[model samples]
Target: MSTPQLLMIEDDARLAQMVGEYLTQSGFGFHHALDGASGLEMLQQRSPDLVILDLMLPDTDGLEVCRRIRAMPSNALAKVSVLMLTAKGDPMDRIIGLEIGADDYLPKPFEPRELLARIRAVLRRRGEGGSDAAPAAVMRFGTLEIDRNARTVTVGGMAADLTSYQFDLLVAMAERAGRVLTRDQIMEAVRGRELEAFDRSIDVHMGRIRAAIEVDAKNPKRILTVRGVGYVFAKQQD
Candidate 1:
């Protein structure tokens, strides 16, 4: 495939300039917009493969922009993956970003290499369409159907619109239904990445997955939270 296209919507002009130079060397077709409005307009014009969105924009919040992208009519634009950047201290920013459909997030004041790794991982997870991974058995939990081969999910015969990350997360838990897997274990199953001391994006991603599959996200039955242990998929479905 061609060099993956990327659009960075950030208000930090100095940071944007520095990132632009790095991305050019890293083999990406890159563009930058200083605000959310221009970013949305150029999103249609570019149809990029991935977006590096800053959580704090001058005109609007990045979460809102992410919502708009997912709501866009064009299949290419709507499904385009997003990577959010935010301050390191505010944990809520990361959670909110995922809740609104961001594919991944990296905290601010991060190394360039870390950002590149996140960008590549998010793009690979979204772009592969399950081609690179080995096929797994399809999972059926009563009215919920998970086709690992097709990377699709259906609840009560209705399709669940899940992002690539959410789908992988659901599949991970479903594969071990009835067994609670800690956040580290879940991350390992999905990405094979080493666990960090305080990586809470798992919960945020789980919330998004519940919203997509559960009959009532506010009171979920499919994926049960084990309080401090983590989450478990129901072995017996209604």
Candidate 2:
């Protein structure tokens, strides 16, 4: 396997330098962009395996940058792994980041080792930062179709826009069909990690999925919540 390439978009020159050097020594190929605009330009040009994006950038907002990447029509660019760096302690920022398709994040003034660990975790969750594995099989339910091999989903024969994480969550639930999975189970299956206390991240992602899959997101029929329990995929499709 080739070394994973990483792009870091940070306006703090000194901090970026230190972190870049550290990540390089830690076995990743590093590219540094000083602001969001240049970073996004580099993103289009290089398409790194993962991005280390700081929330505050000189030319643009970090959140907007993430949104732009996730909005790309190209599957490869839209699904690229992102690990956010922010100085804010607000949980809202983290929630927003995840909602915008960031794979993970670390609040600023963090240890470089922790950043390294997060990078690895995000990459692992993104199927070792790259996957050429054969798609398992096709799953069909009414107008909804999931092509595991292609990692594509379509509703009514039209392609549905979904982030990589959203797709994983949908597949995990759809595979189980009638099972009512707890939060821990769902998190474990999709993220390979347990849910944290007071972590509503799963719910946020679930809403995103519903909007993409359900004809009426306000009255979702596919993935239904089980009150105190987690959620369940409808076994019987109309």
Candidate 3:
């Protein structure tokens, strides 16, 4: 199989070089751009399988770059995945990246091994032969609709802003509507990995998702939490 092509847009010379080297050694084909404008140009000229984008850039803002990339014709970014790389560890920053269409977010000061694992996980989730059938091309439950191709969710016909984790969690549950999924199962399916201690991260994400999709987050109807198990997607039966 051909190596996956990656585009890295980062202004930090030393860090960029180090990351590039790591990715190279991992058998990935990649190119680097030091500024946002050049990165955008490269994106338009040469489509890549994935992008590792930094928030701080010389020419253009990373958020703007993400917006522009998402605005590009589907033919341009149809199969491309974006992983936002930033020094900002703020929860809001992560939320914004996902809202702007990034597929994943990795804060800076991260271990190279973790970065590689995240990249591989994102690719695996998007690639063929996963455990579950690819999330539906379009999944609808009540007024909530999820479009996997568009990577978007809408509630009552209005677009709902969701973090990447929140979107993944909702999709995981919605795909298997009416089934109760344990917390561990939910984490495994959505995160593509096992959970560790202090993994209440999933609970936080689930809360956010419920707020976005549930008419009443305090008393959610769709995402029901079972007493001893995890949660369930209670789609009303006809």
Candidate 4:
């Protein structure tokens, strides 16, 4: 297999060098850009398997880069995963990153090991190790369709424009439709890992999913809360 290609877009020279060295040692072919413009240029020239994007770049912001990437032709963006990195840890910042089409987000001042783990996890979830026949592509659930291969979603025959995390959460629920999945279960399925103590990221992702797919997010019918247990995807009638 070819080495996984990674594009790192970070303004911090020291941090970039450290990350590049780590990824190189991990058997990845990596490239770096000091600013968003150069990063975008690199992306257009040769798409990478994954992108490590920094939110606060000297030129265009990472969020804009994500948006531009998403707006690219589906064929171009397909199979390219994006992991956003930033110092901003606010819930809104995370949400915006995801909303703009990042496959994952990590706050700054993070350990290189954690970053490596996240990259591996995202690739695994995207079905990097599986055979070609494995269903790593689109999954349909009623009027809601999730194109995992493309990282896009559609609701009631229209584009839903959901965040990457929201799409993953919805896909998880759809995969086990009509079955109650606990918070831990959902987190494991969508994030490919367990959450730390007091982490409500799952809830946030679920709420965003509900907002996209449910007619009334306040009284969600598609994703029903099962009291103390967790939640379930209410069976849709034919």
Candidate 5:
């Protein structure tokens, strides 16, 4: 298998250099762009497997960059996994990033080891960074179809746009259809990380997933929320 390539769009040159070295030593091909524009161009040219986007950029904000990536004309590029880097202690920034389609986020001033772990987790959900293998399986519920091999979800034969993390979250819930899972349980199932108190990242991703698969995101039918609980995937859907 080819080495996974990562693009880091960070304006902090020293930090980027250090991270590039660390990731490169850890068996990844690393590339760097000082600003969002150059990073977007590099994304098209290099087609890296994942991107580490910094929230504060010299040219444009990371939120706009993530939006542009999701809006790209090329589906492959648009769907490429994104792991954002946000300011430490800023939950709002992370929430906004996730809402706009980032696969995951790591706060600044973090240990390099934690960053590495987050990257591996994001890629593992996308079925790239892990060595474990499983047979491809397809799950169907009414008009919704989830193809595990292709890592795709479709509704009534039309493809649903979902980020890598969101896709895994949907699969985890679908696998346990009709069972209510708390936000921590859901995040643990997909991300293997405990959620911080008051963290609403799971809610953000769930909203995005509903928007992709539900005919009416406002009144979701496929994934239902249990007040004072978590969420449950409907066993029967149309």
Candidate 6:
């Protein structure tokens, strides 16, 4: 397997340098851009496996950058994983980042080890299309089809756009269709970590998925909300 490449879009030169060095030593190909424009340019040019984006940039907002990334014309680039870095106590920024398609977030003033772990976790989930024990390469439910080997989803033979993180969440829920899963259960199913009590990132991703797969996101038919609980992937999807 090729070494995973990472691009960090951060304005703090000293912090970017330290992170670059640390990630480099940890066996990753690391690159840095001082601002969002340069970062987006580098993203198109290098096509890194994942982006480590700082929430605050001098030129463009990190959330906007994430939105633009998700809107890219090329499917490969649009689906690239993004892990955002936000300031401490800025929970709203983190939530906004996720709402706009960021895969994960780590707060500022974090240990390099923790950052490394988060990076690995995001990449791991992206690559885990399905395990050997998985039943089939493609899972179908009515008009919705999930191709594990291709890492793609289609509804009524039309492609469904989904970020890597969102795709994994969909797969997790689809695999356990008919079960009512709580937020924590869904998070643990995807990444082996319990959901943080206050974190609504999973719900954000689910909304994105429903928008992509459901004909009408406002009244989703594929993934249903089990009011007062969590959600369920309808075994009988239309």
Q: In model 1, which runs have C-alpha deviations exceeding 4 angstroms?
A: 129-137, 192-199
| TM-score on alpha carbons, each prediction | 0.88, 0.90, 0.69, 0.79, 0.97, 0.93
lDDT of 5 by residue, 8-73 (tens): 999999999999999999999999999999999999999999999999998899999999999999
In the range 1-238, model 2's lDDT, one tens digit per residue, is 8899899999999998999899999989999999888998999999898999999998888999999999887778888888899999788898999888887778889999989878886776566655457358999999999987788899999888776677888999999999999988998886543445877888888888998889998899999999999999997775
Model 3 C-alpha lDDT per residue in residues 1-238, reported as the tens digit of each score: 6688889999998998999999999988889999988897898777887889998788877888888887776544744778888787567676676666677778788899988888888776665213355545998887888987666899989877664456677889988899999888887776664445544556666777877888888988888999878889998921
Residue 205 in model 5: lDDT: 92
- lDDT value for candidate 5? 0.91
Clashing pairs in 4: none
Each candidate: RMSD to true structure? 2.4, 2.1, 4.8, 3.4, 1.2, 2.1
Task: Give the runs in model 2 whose Cα sits over 4 Å from its true position.
Answer: 130-135, 193-195
lDDT per residue as tens, model 1, 179-224: 9898888988878334357767788888888999988999999999
In model 3, the runs with Cα more than 4 Å from the true position are 75-79, 128-171, 180-184, 193-231
> Cα miss at 161, model 5 (Å)?
0.5
Find the 10 residues in a row with the least total lDDT in model 3. Answer: 127-136
Each candidate's lDDT (Cα)? 0.85, 0.86, 0.77, 0.78, 0.91, 0.87
Error of 2 at 39 (Å): 0.5
Cα error, candidate 3, residue 166 (Å): 7.4
Sort order, TM-score high to low: 5, 6, 2, 1, 4, 3
Ranking by lDDT: 5, 6, 2, 1, 4, 3
Clashes of 3: 0
Instruction: Kindly report which residue pairs in candidate 6 clash with one another.
Output: none
**Candidate 1 collision pairs:** none
Regarding TM-score, does 1 or 2 come out ahead?
2
lDDT of 6 by residue, 1-238 (tens): 6889999999999999999999999989999999999999999999999999998899988988999999999888998899999885756787788878888888888899988888888887777322343345899998888998688899999999887778889999998999999888888888743456887788788888989999999999889999989999989855
* Predicted model with the maximum lDDT: 5
Worst 10 residues of 5 by lDDT: 188-197
Please report how far candidate 2 places residue 189 from its true position, in Å: 1.2
